[model samples]
Structure formats: C-alpha cells, structure tokens
Target: MAGIPHYYLYGEPGAGVDRDLLHIEPVRDRSGPNDWRIRPHAHPDHMQVMLVADGGGTIRMEDRTLAVPSPGVLVIPAGIVHQIDFDPGTDGHVITAALPCLAAAGAQDPALGRAAGQAAAYPLDGSGVDVAAAIEAFRSLQREFLWAAPGRRAAIIAQFSRILVLILRLSLIHRAPAIGAADHDLLVRYRALVEAQFRSHHPPAHYAALLAVTPARLNAACKARAGRTASDILHDRLVVEAKRYLIYTESSVAQVAHLTGFEDPAYFNRFFTRRVGCAPGAFRRQAAES
Candidate 1:
C-alpha cells in the first residue's frame, strides 16, 4: 500500500479501501443548493446509496435513465457512469460507501445484493420515510463515534446493515421482460467502463472505441435512454471523483491536481474553486473542521 499508487487503490486494499466493518455516514436536510445534482461520474471501486425524500426526477446510467419519484432510493455499484438530477423542488439524502463493504456483508445478506450488483442499483419505490429514519440514526451514530468514542466501527457496521436492508425492501421497478440480457449486460459494462476511464479519456469517441461502437451510436443510446449526452456524463463523473480526492485526502493541492489528471496544479485549483465555490485547500480545511 505504501508503494502502490492511489489510483491502483480504486476499490483496492489501501487508503479509502472499502470496509465491511466501518462506514462514515452523513445526514443533511434542506442544506441549500449543495452537492445536489451530482454530475455524472463513476467510482472505480465504490458504490453509492441514495434516497429521495421529496420530489421526482431522473437517474441516468450508461445505457438507461430511470424516472425517480420521491420516497425512493438508489444503489450505484462501482465502475458505473451515472448522474442524478433531483426534482427542482425536492430535497434528499445520500449514503455512499465502498463496494467491498457491501460484499463483506455476506452475499446472502439481502442488503448485499440490493447494493452490490444489478438487482441492487434501483431499490426505492416508496420508502423515503424509512430511508430517512435509518439515515438519521446512522448519522447520529457517526457523530457520536466521532466525538465520544474511538472504537465504534463494529456498531457502525451493524447500524449501516439495517439501513441497507430497509433500502432493499422497497419494491423494484418492473422493466419489460423483453429487454435482452445481452443489452442489459452491455449497459452495465458501459457504466463500469465510464467509471474506470472517465478521469483520463473523456470523449465519447474514445469510449465508443473501447466499447467497439461508433460515437454517434453511443450518443444516441445514452441520450435516448439515460436522458443525457455521453459528454455530460463523462465530465460530471470526472469532477465528482476530483472533489472527493480534494476533500478527503491529505495530499497537497498540487498532488490532488496531478492525481485528478490535471497537467498543472494551479489550473486544477482554479477549476476546483470555480465549480465548487472555494479553493481546494480552503474546502479541505473547512470540511476537516466540520
């Protein structure tokens, strides 16, 4: 871990590695317009779980975008390209964790499948209240663990498991029985590809070449099904990961710049502030204090 690069740690065993027994959960309500409408992006090795507390919108993936109504939740697996646009009038909470944590929770645990593979991505039908309750409890525990104790990792995992199970109980969408398995598989694969490559090569053409499809064709599929352009998804994906690295790692701004594929750390700093409303270091300092 000491010698291996962090990029290789994408879902690997090192810093930010997924934990079966440790989860840092957050809770926010009416938090103003912040971290909402997360850009399209992918996690090379982590999965994200989110619940819609109010309103309705759409969630775009590599191959398809699904309509999301309030009282719903979602599980996004690692290595997928996707983005969420909350209903302009809606507010919600999101829980993101590494996939290794999901897997470590035994495959048989309903939450694992609800958050690990295809069956797990879209789980919210009308469970917003429950999701909110679980998240509230999770957040409470997180705050307590942070301020009061040093060894509550076990308790955190147990509580998080309850949250996942609540998410899994929501009724799933019944997509047509006609969508061929191959197409479904392709959709999943395309998302995974975007997750792994969005940071480096962002053009749809580059991705189409990897997928062995024409850029135009890929664009059509993404637009028609996912409700957005491939370029949009690609850029959003890159930015989110960049934000995570900037906020969570102790690496210097220059180093975060390099890790995010920026040729110049100064330019990266400018870009980060422009989009995020603050300089990378400033945001890091503020987040640390919070």
Candidate 2:
C-alpha cells in the first residue's frame, strides 16, 4: 500500500475550496474527466452528498462495495476512504460542504447530523418522497452555490439542511419498525461516540460511562437498533479503521498495529485474522492485487 490521495475535492489537491462553506457541481464535471471512475481518496474536512438522477454504478467505501441505484442519494462522511465508478453520462449533482457547516446544521437537528455522518445510499423510487421536489431542491442548491448574491452562505446552508432533512426522512422510512425512537437515539449517540473513540481501543463500558448509561443499557440499545452488542459496535469500528490503514498506508504490519492502538503486533495480527479471516499483511496484499 502507498499513501492514499487526500483531496479537497475528488481530483483537486488543496487545503480547501474557495467557497469554503460548500461546493456544488454536476457529477460529470469531475467524474467524466476521470473516465467516470473515482479512485480511493479521502477528504480530511469535508463531507459529500451525491444525488444520482440517472444511470448507476458502484461505490466502494473501505472494503465494502455497493451498487448505486439511479435516482438515489449517497452520503460520504469526512475522512472516509471511498471510490465511486459512475456509468458514463451519469447525471446528478454532488454537494461538498465543510465539516463546520455540517456541524452547525447538526447542532440544530441531531437526527440530520447522524444521517449525514453515515455513508449510505437511499433509493428514492419507492421511498414516498417527492422526487421532483428533491430534484428542485438540488437545482436550487446548485444555483445558490454558483451565484454571488447576498445571503449566499445562509441560502446554501438552508438548502443543504433541506436535503439532509429529506435524507433523514428517507432513512426513517426505511428503518426497521422494531426499533423505537429512544433506542434509535441511543444507538445514534453510541455510534457518534464510537467514531470519536474507536482509535483509542476503549471498551464499551467506557462509552457507556460517557453516555451516562450503564453498560447493560447501552448493549441493549445497540442490540435493539443495530442488531449488534455495544462491544461489537466498538470492535467493528476498530476493525474498519484498521482495514483503512492497512489498505491506504504503506506502514508495516507492526506499525499499523500500534497506529490502531494495539501494543503487541502479534495480538493485532491475531485479532485481525479472527475478525477478517486473514492476517493484516495478507489483507493488504489482497487489496493491492484487487
């Protein structure tokens, strides 16, 4: 593995975009130039929301590759290593917003925040959402993003928030009815905590403590909402991050172990093999070959 490219936008290498708050453009504007294939990359401080209006392809986030449905929405959180292969002439809009902008929006609505943080695809065909209205919203957002009019920043935020709220609704509609609101909310908070602390290798009890709940309560909530125990959620997050490091960095296996919070390289190797069915070195070699 070599160093993965970190870009402000897909192919643009820079600290940040000029607009700073948000950037909107047709998917073809960037993907078309690269033959509709975006290689694996990460944006350190930006998240992306892509609306695929026509055509479809596959998106790879870390080790998982999922097909993109036409007339769907895709969310990519900041700092995630992802790639997208779009069908030629795929028509859609991609919205790139700064982390601060998302944070501000999330401060107002936690559900929206959670939805944005997750990387997912929501097909709008049978989602009960007004597809035409959603497209109009994207167009309005792109217009505001391009114009140098007064109150441009606020308008962009407003439009972005609207899209997020729509995504949230779609997520809720698709979510299992078995999970109650309180359990869902707790799961959301638990996920947020995992994202922040996964690299530290903390136990579930540590997270439960931070969330002001007992470990049993946290585990139950996680089981109800995510179909995993709280410990599983934490360990799964750790494994995902470990896979990212192995696939994206040229660090030695031992170094990768320490970087992912393991003190003993042998222990890390055993852990990786147990969960992933291969040693870290083998995993990296396989990824490179693929």
Candidate 3:
C-alpha cells in the first residue's frame, strides 16, 4: 500500500515540533467543517484524548469500526491509523498533546501511563465513574489551554493528568481478567515484536524464543493481558495489515496476499475469509461502497 497520511493534526501536514504542545478545542471546530468525518490518518509524535459530550458516531481503527458512545472518552495513541465519522452537530472537546507531555504526566502513575498509551473508548453513563468531575476537568483544560496566564503550562498538564486518571479508573472497571506486572510487560514486548516482524510471517513460537520464554508462558501472558492466545495476537496483526492494504491500495487479492507474507495466495484467501467472514475482495468492495 501507499504511505498512509501522517499529520500532526488530521489535515495539517508535517510533524509537530513543540515538545510541550497541548492543544484543546471543541470537537466541532474541526469535524463540523469536514461534515463530521475525520478521514484515515496518523499522528507520528502526538496522542489525542477526546471527550464526547454530545452526539456520537463510529471510529474506524485499522480493520475494525466501533461505535462511539456519547458522554464518553477516547484515548488514541500516537501512530495509529484511524478515521472518525460523527453524527452531525456532535459536541465535545479534543485534546491533542505531545507524547513527551503525556509521558511526563504519566511518570508518577504507571497505570495512568498505560491507560493513555492504548487506544480505548469508555462510556461515562452508568459506569460508576465520576462523570461530572471528568467533564469539569475537560472544561478546565480547555480554559488553561486557551490562555497565557502564569503557570498555564502547569495547570494544563494537571488537568489533563486528572482526565487520564479518570480514564484509567474506567478502564480498570471494564478490563479483562487482571494480569500481573510481569505478564503485562511480556504482552507489551510481544506486541512490539509483532509490530516489527509481523510481515515476516513468524510464528508465535518464534516470538517466544526471541523473548527467551517458552511458548506456553508466552501464550499464558498474552491470554491474561489481551484475552487472546499468542498465536491469535500475531494472526490479528497480520489480518489488520492485510485489511489496510486491501482498503487503501489498488493491489489485487493475490498481490495483497503476497504483500502480507503468504506465498500461496489461496491459503491467504482462506485464512482471511475465515477470520473476517468475507473474502478480501468482498471486504474491499464493501469498504468502498460504505
């Protein structure tokens, strides 16, 4: 596939330079002008947290599309290819900040750091979270971001950090079976390896060897942290990459299979169809028509 668009902000080309950058604006400011649709794009060096205070829609991340729950929050990590389609007149706030800013904020709380590092959506209604406190934090962040008052930077970071804490609380409530720190660390390492070597078609066992762990241990860690087997994680990464090529490129099915590390196009076809419940070509066509 051709290079996916990378922007500091959705339509703005080029990377951001400000290490302390923290931008907050109403969601409609950008989404409204574009008909409430944010096309597939990536931010190379920044992360975003969005609060959906009003209407909602769907978010397309890699190969999956998830409904955006209103009165919710979305944490999007840097370098994820995503698209957002919002219902008209959706009102909310989107906070875009440099990765360093988040890292610094998360330094004191590892859970907060972990929560902000992943892409997740949480609905505020009936979740037992302090929704009012979270909303007020967003409002406070917007005010601090808009002004040049003394200690503005500190105030912005403090408010944004509060939001992250709230998100972490919600995530814990919705999380799968809790995993120990070692297991979580192993899962993170495994995911990083998959991101680097997925196109090589390495088996999960190969990854386990590289991590100096047995296959059983690797699988156990992945299951505990991600609710998936080690093999499932590798296969899911492959499927996500295949979907990206199919949707964003003009490559034929055979070429896509080859690009995704399958020497036998027929095998790739079967694998994709079984996992996605549709042939690659059919999925592409459906994506285009939608």
Candidate 4:
C-alpha cells in the first residue's frame, strides 16, 4: 500500500529529525498560507495537541468528519489518519510531540502512558481551568523549543508531560459514566499486553497470568471499561491486524493468516468471518475496490 507523508511538524515530508523530539507552533503559522485547510494524512509515530482559543472548523478522521468549535482542545493520537481545517482567523497553539518522548516520561507510570494513547476533540467548559492551562503549556513549550537555552530540551519535554496531564484530567472530567481508576488502568494494561502478544494468539488466561491477575478479574475490568470481555478484546485485536495485512499487502490468504498468527488458513478464514462479517479474500477485494 502507498504511504502517507511523514514530517517533523508541518515541514516538508521525510525531513531528517530526531524521532524522540517535538515541534510546537501556532495553528495560524502553518494553516494561514494554505487556506486554513489541511488534507487527510497520517503521522506514523507522532501525537498532537491543539488548544483553540477562538474560531472553529471540522476535522476528518478516517471515515468520519467532526465539527469542532473554538475554545476547545484536540488530541490526535499516533498512527491515526486525521486532517483539520481551521476557520479563517482562528487562533490556536498546536503542540506536536514524539510518541517516544511520552513513552519515556511514562515508563514508570502506566496511567500516563495510557493517557497519551487517547485521541479526542471537545470544547472546553467555560468555567474550567483546563483550557487556559493547556494554551499556556503549549506556549511555554514553543518558547523552550525555539530558544535552545540551557536544558531547553529537558524543559520542553517537561512541559509536554505537563500538557498531557492536563488533557487527561480534562478528559476524565468530561467523559460520561466516568471510568473508575482501577478499571481504566486494567484496560490500559490489557491494551498494552495485546500490542505485545497479539501475534502469538495467546489466550485471555495467558494475558491474565502475565498481568498477574486472574482471568475473571481481567474480564471484569474489560467489561466495565469497554463493554467487552477480555476474550473479545484479544479476538478484535487479531482481526484488526489481519484486516490491515489483507488490505495493505500483496500477501495471499494463507500468508496473511500466518502473519496474523493463524497457522491454518481455514481456521483463520472462519475467525475473520466470525469477527469481521466476511471472509478474508472478500474483505481484501472490497477494501481494494473502495
């Protein structure tokens, strides 16, 4: 499959830059000359935060387009296809940070890592401090990133983490049927485990053992946080990877099956059919045609 352009911020695609670094700027700086519109694109391993002070527009994420008004925040997680159009004269600060930076900062705290993985957009509450703090955080980041003074990089990274904390707090405050801390943590752990072991086709019990939790407890957490069981989570992850392979590669069905952890093509076909509502070949054909 064809690849989307990769860049360090809004600069030219494929520019050589440190993978663990970040770029900070105002939305107007980049969007002004381009009619305030950005076409759909994917960032391979970068995360973005935008603090809009006034004005608004729409966002395109995958197959959905969302209306976004000003006085809000936008969090774009890594690897998602997204695009944004700013209203003319919109005012905002955009903070683009490398995923590795957040990962390193959160190495000892799984909750922080989990927060960095969320993608969302919503208007800030009028009486809340989140919007103000978020805007100032990005401004500080931009100054530190540009000044290159003593410990500039360290200061910028610290500001990045601080911004993430504020955003996560805001998310919790605004999300409905708020997730309990324990349930959120468990779901994050499950997602991380799935990322590491989905290729192995490990059972839910295996994941629970690795997490040092009982399978029943894990299932409870998944059901509480996501309305799905742990087993369903694992199966869904497997099917997602399988669909990606089938759509993006020239691999045959058997090859795709093996690559996605099914050694038996027939079994893989059935699994895909059950979860994805179609056979693998048919899925591939439909995706290609679309």
TM-score of 4: 0.59
Tens digit per residue, CA lDDT, model 3, 59-90: 87655577898999987766556799999999
lDDT of 2 at 163: 92
Candidate 2 lDDT score at position 161: 91
lDDT of each: 0.56, 0.79, 0.80, 0.73
Model 2 has a clash total of 0
Better of 1 and 3 by lDDT: 3
Q: What TM-score fits each model?
A: 0.46, 0.61, 0.61, 0.59
Residue pairs of candidate 4 with colliding backbone atoms: none
Task: Please list all clashing residue pairs in model 3, or write none if there are none.
Answer: none
- Deviation of model 3 at 164, angstroms: 0.8
Worst window of 10 by summed lDDT in candidate 3? 176-185
The per-residue C-alpha lDDT of model 2 at residue 13 equals 70
Model 4 C-alpha lDDT per residue in residues 79-190, reported as the tens digit of each score: 4567788889887888777655666556656666666666667677663755666677777888888896988767877888787777767667666222224655576677
- Which residue runs does candidate 3 get wrong by more than 4 Å? 14-19, 176-290
